[model samples]
Target: MGKQMFSKPPIQKSHELLLPTTKESCWILVFLLAFGVSSIHGDDGKIDFRYHHYLDLSRVLNDTAASCHEISRVYSVGKSVEGRDLWVIEFSDNPGVHEPGEPEFRYVGNMHGNEAVGREILVYLVQYLCSGYQAGDARIRRLIDQTRIHIMPSMNPDGFERAATLGPDSPRTSTSWGSYGRLNSERIDLNRNFPDMLPVWLLQEESQRRNHHVEIPEWYWDTLVAPETLSVILWSLSQPFVLAGSLHGGSVVVSYPFDSCGLRKVMRSYSEAPDDALFRKLAKVYVDGHRKMGKCGQVEPCNARNFTCKGGMTNGAEWYCVPGGMQDFSYLVTNCLEMTFELSCDKYPGEDELQTYWEDNKEALLSYMEAVHTGIKGFVRDGSGKGVANATISVEGVDHDVTTGELNIFDIKTYFLIPQRLTETTGDCSFRGLTG
Candidate 1:
């Protein structure tokens, strides 16, 4: 709530099956579709930019781990409606352990099955990180050494299978591209399937409106939420995420929370969060890092939409109301600061265009990850030198506050650092995993 400044930096499951059958046998079709079926790497050692089957995705992640075993590991968060594993590849110096004072960052792609760009681009990112670190890229090494990065390339795999057409050679017309793969196997829109908290926020008094870590209602558990949504909820809560990016498609802009404006669905008014300035800065980080996004209407995707923002950034609700969006949920229910990156005008682009997209967004992705290191972080300890648990870390005049200890959905706890400008008057900064 105050602008004060400082210098510098720091930082599973099993299910059984209902396989969808196409005109071609799934296995044979997938193999033929993958251009070079044996390897994902090209002659120059860069990943081939193309659409990949779920099996191909798994292989890419595992192969990366095997090749870069010292700094990476592959794991599954849960299963989808059609029994596909939601795989996550984590990059850290200590791989599986949560290092003290090290922030956890995540990039979740393809929440919508038709939004294939985010999914494939993330695979490119995985390859870039592992290869860059192995090649002794100083910036990449610094990121891997100081921060823990988790990337789930495709969150809705079942929908992706439905959306991705025959192979790289198959024709994708305008009619077929955007319509088929937007939802999950249950026909649920994963983006809108999370619990909505707009009503809850409206009910709270003005002073209590900016409250963080709002609990999920018990009734939410009994609803018809998609399995994919539930999987992400559990995964997001189980870790201490400092910053997150939800990659999407259909337009090119960066959107920050609060995404919904209670009941007034049709109105295009801004719903400013308590940390609005901080959120705007985060969105600008991506916009400025990209080649064309910051130019706004001058770029291809931006011009297509006729969108005009100073830096191709807009508040989520102002752009258009999106209730139950993951971007809003990440901030409301957890300590994570999340934003949505709409990467292209085409939701599902041709395989030929994947390489261009990777080049366009690569810098922005790395810069955003590096941002997790710019904030303040420390522990909340008592006079006895033991860390204090369930403690609230409040800043004067800032409505939103972070808590210390562990993180979980039912009773969530924050990990580290408020990125905003702070002074001594704004007391109480705390961290996670520091108990004696």
Candidate 2:
């Protein structure tokens, strides 16, 4: 039970058929009304301000590393668009080294500068884990000992600093001009800037077979490669991450992939991921922790317009289609299962509200991190008990099968760093394709 830090660096699916009808669609309509009202409706400036500016956050993280030197280290993954170093705080028995049979977990916060709730919680999370370990908490000791945990408290520093409604160059927010502050500095919505998952041709120059299609008027996206998004993509690629989540705001729900609805459609649509059952359990951990997230009634959403995210979860696109989102990109291109957590109803909660928000979410955060260990993992061995190298590992209900790597341990795309957890009750006897 201990803690340390280095320089600076940075770092779901479920199958269900609950189609939206005209009646259920009312939630969407009421939500739009509530959202619009919330935009204009301020908290009477009664809220205080206590969030960290970019430099202050750096100092805090650096201090944490200096204190927990043994169990922690600080390093820089990459820089932001405006050249601010994207610092990462690592907590593990051994930081920066890949351990066999160990799963890597990551939490990214404040992808949207204005949506500051996530960034704040992540800051607390680092301290929470560090302090717990120092206090000799067994849970903290086991988590850091068994898994690699990476936390990026602020992914969009520039956007947070911008203090504007939208990206300066964005036409979408040209007239609205309030405090949307949702896009990155270049004015592109980072959430909507990742490579789209819908099967369609990019610019004619890019073919179907190419791995990265980054050359669009905006690279098949409306915005070019904002440095923040690029930094995250590279960091995830460099690790053997199995489970990840990003913190967001403006809603109080946990959204799982695919963020897009295959193609562009205005209304709600359905797209089930390969591992729908697995994803559901992962989300339920958080929703169940925060019973309010799964509840709808007095003061909360009983219908579409006012905090109406039923059961506290929904498919990203089914709520509404958003192409090129980060959640979908993580699953389609990497060995990670990432979910976007809309932590609070307010994109940026006031200073006094920060602690209360943390109280509500801290348990869910800790639980979700622990949930990574609940999934299935083991070597696929032979009759003589010899290791089986390069053996195919397939799950029947799931779309893709994984192939074993060097140790013949059915590692899947792990060599390439491709992704989850298996539970005893739910995971037992699952995946029919472990063949001869």
Candidate 3:
């Protein structure tokens, strides 16, 4: 089929908050005025359900690093359109420095600011990993020692503030940004604002190859890659990331790549990746760790009648298309295999239900990081048992390959490094290091 103009579905209305059905009062949201708020917190001074506003989140990051400078480092990778710093907390013994042969993984939260659960969970992750390390937890220590993991709690801080500022019972906007803060400052959906791969795939010829970024025309300059998107794009490219999964709200399932088919929207279809099996394994590791995310039989399937994602994992396009999604862009452009995690059914869950979320997802969060070690990762030696630095590693029949670093070790996600055989003798290897 020829290229079709992408007219995606309208934004969902489920993000609006509902009033509590209490006997004392029906929980009427009395908005005295939208403009006058002493602070972003609730009347009690904190949005308790473990949720923190932008200021508090930043404070938590600083405090975490302040308390544990030995194993943690806090820095801003980029800022939002509204000039909010995109804070990233890296957890490692050698936090700021990148060691060769060590693979990196990242978890990004609050891509949609209204989806507050992910943002809160990611903030909590900093405390969980850091305090766990201090407590001499073997698992936490092992993870920190082995992987260079980063948690970006709020990629869209401006949107978060906007969402929190609006509060509940506010009228929804239809044109661009949702009722709350779903989009960035300019009201563009960040998830739908990337250099879409489907167009590049169809346009690129074998002789004139171009990357997802390089292939874009001048017409797509401002809208295609927003400041927030560019911030994450550059930050992600700077690291040798093996995996980068984002936490989104509005559903409860693990969604893998190919978010858009690059064609007109259809009711149902599946879009498989070159490394579908590896993606499945990675998603399963996460879903299985969650107490309820993996069980697909009766009580909680992704969609009871129409679908059955055996292990609570769905291909992004098959489930529903999200054009210009970060997941697809990360995979198609770089070595990182990005996945989209729909963490909750409610875009903005109430505060009282926050602890339940932490308990539900904490184990899954830790286990997903362990997946970076699932594929063949270790040192590559030569014939005489010497470390072979910069040697290309390829498996027969696989299109991609990874090279060993100065440390003589190569670590790669199986998503792109799908090797059927053991040696690089059969074919030429193209992917040298997961670094951009």
**210 in model 2: Cα distance from truth in Å?**
15
lDDT of 3 by residue, 1-436 (tens): 1111223311112211111111111111111111111111112112234668888998999998888899899999877887788999998879897765567889999888788889988887788777777777787888889788999999888788888775532223342247468887777788988767765654563446522222233444534356777678667555657777799876788889778876556644787666666677677777777767856564354345322245677888887787788887777655677898888766666777877887778778887886665543444344445544334444333333343334212423111222122222222223224321
* lDDT, residue 192, candidate 3: 88
What lDDT score goes with residue 351 in model 2? 71
Q: What is the lDDT of every predicted structure here?
A: 0.72, 0.62, 0.64
Off by over 4 Å in 1: 1-45, 166-179, 206-210, 301-305, 407-415, 425-436
Model 1, 1-436: lDDT tens digits are: 1111222110012110011111111010000010111111212166767888899999999999999999999999988888899999999999997776788999999898888899998999999889888888787888899899999999999878878754432214554443467777777788887878765656664555444556665556656777678878777766778899999987888989889886677656898887787787777778767777867446754453354345688888887888888978888776788999989877787788988888778878887887777656665554454555545555554455665544322333324555543333322333334311
Task: Report residue 249 deviation for candidate 2 (angstroms).
Answer: 0.4
Question: Per-prediction RMSD in angstroms?
Answer: 13.8, 12.4, 15.4
Query: Could you tell me the TM-score of candidate 3?
Result: 0.76
For 255-298, candidate 2 gives per-residue lDDT tens digits of 88777877446457766776565666677777766636777663
TM-score of each: 0.83, 0.73, 0.76
lDDT of 1 at 1: 15
- Ordered list by lDDT, greatest first: 1, 3, 2
**Candidate 3 lDDT for residue 136:** 73
- Best model per TM-score: 1
Q: Which residues of candidate 2, in runs, are more than 4 Å off?
A: 1-49, 164-180, 200-223, 264-266, 302-309, 379-392, 403-436
